[model samples]
Target: MTQGPIRLDIAVGYATPRKGLPSAVSFRRWATAALAGRIREADLAIRLVGSKEGRALNRHYRGKDYATNVLSFPADLPEGLPPGVRMPLLGDLVICAPVVAREAREQGKSLNAHYAHLTVHGALHLLGWDHEDSREADAMEQLEREILAGLGLDDPYALPGD
Candidate 1:
C-alpha cells in the first residue's frame, strides 16, 4: 500500500556535532511511511537521548532496569465513528538512539536496519499491537517481519544468516 507523507515533531535531548545518527528526521519519515496503516495525522515525538534518560523511562513505565529499543504511548481517543473529518492522532514513539545502536552492533545489523525495525515496531504499538501473549506476540512479529522485509531488511526473528 502506498502511503502519503507525514510531519514529524522530533526533539533531540543530546545533540552533538561529532556523535550520533545523521538525518534522523528523514529516517523517521521513511519508517512512518513504511508502516502506514490506520494512523492518519500522527503527533510523533522521537526523542533521541542518552542511556540514563532511557533507563529512567524504561524502569518507570516498563519495569525494565535498562534501556530498551523503543516505547510507544498511544493517546486514548473515543472509539466510535466520528462526525465531520478528524484525522486519528497516534501518540508518541520514543526511541533511545544509543540503545538502538548498541543492539544493532550486537545483532550484527546496520544502524539503519535496526532503526527501521524499532520505528516500525513502535508505530505498530501506537496502532495497538502488544506482545504479552502468544497470539499477540505472533501477530506483532508477523507484522514486523513484513514491514522490515518491505524495507529490504532481514527477518528480525531468524538467526543472522548468510
Candidate 2:
C-alpha cells in the first residue's frame, strides 16, 4: 500500500503556510492528472523552509550556494520492471515558499499557479524525468504546459518577463 496510482501523502514541515497550499482535493486531482494515472503509488513531503535551510540544501546537493525554487530527493526504489512491479518510495520535494511567492510576484503569475508548476515539476522528477538537455527540457516543459493548462492556468513558460 506504499505505492499506487497517484498515492500522495503530503507532509509539511518548517513554516510553510498550510492555508496557502492547494487543498487536498485539488492536489489529488492535479497530481493524478499530471502523472497520467501511471503512478502505482506516490508520496510527497512538501516542506516550506527559510532561505538559510534552502541554501544549505542547494549547496550540499547541487553545489549551488543560493536557495532554489525546488529540490527533489528521489527514493532508492528497486530497479527494473517485471510486469506489475510499481515504483515506490518515489521521493521528497523541498520548496521555499518565500522564494516561490517572490518569483510569482516578480513574474506576475498567480501564487497558486506557481505552486502548481513547482509541484508538477518535482513530481515529474520523481517519475524518472529530467531536463538536462534542450530536448528533454522541451519535453518536460510541454508536459508542464499541458498539465497546468488542465488546471486552468496560462503557460508558465510564456509568462511575461520569464
| Winning model by TM-score | 2
Best by lDDT: 2
Task: Give the poorly placed runs of model 2, Cα more than 4 Å off.
Answer: 1-6, 17-29, 77-87
Give me candidate 2's TM-score against the actual structure.
0.79
> Considering only N, C-alpha and C atoms within 3 Å, which residue pairs clash in candidate 1?
none
How do the residues 90-121 of candidate 2 rate in per-residue lDDT, one tens digit apiece? 66778887788899999988888887888788
Candidate 1 C-alpha lDDT tens digits along 114-158? 777777788778777899999999999998898788767788877
Q: What is the C-alpha lDDT of each candidate?
A: 0.70, 0.75
When summed lDDT is taken over every stretch of 10 residues in candidate 1, the lowest stretch is: 9-18
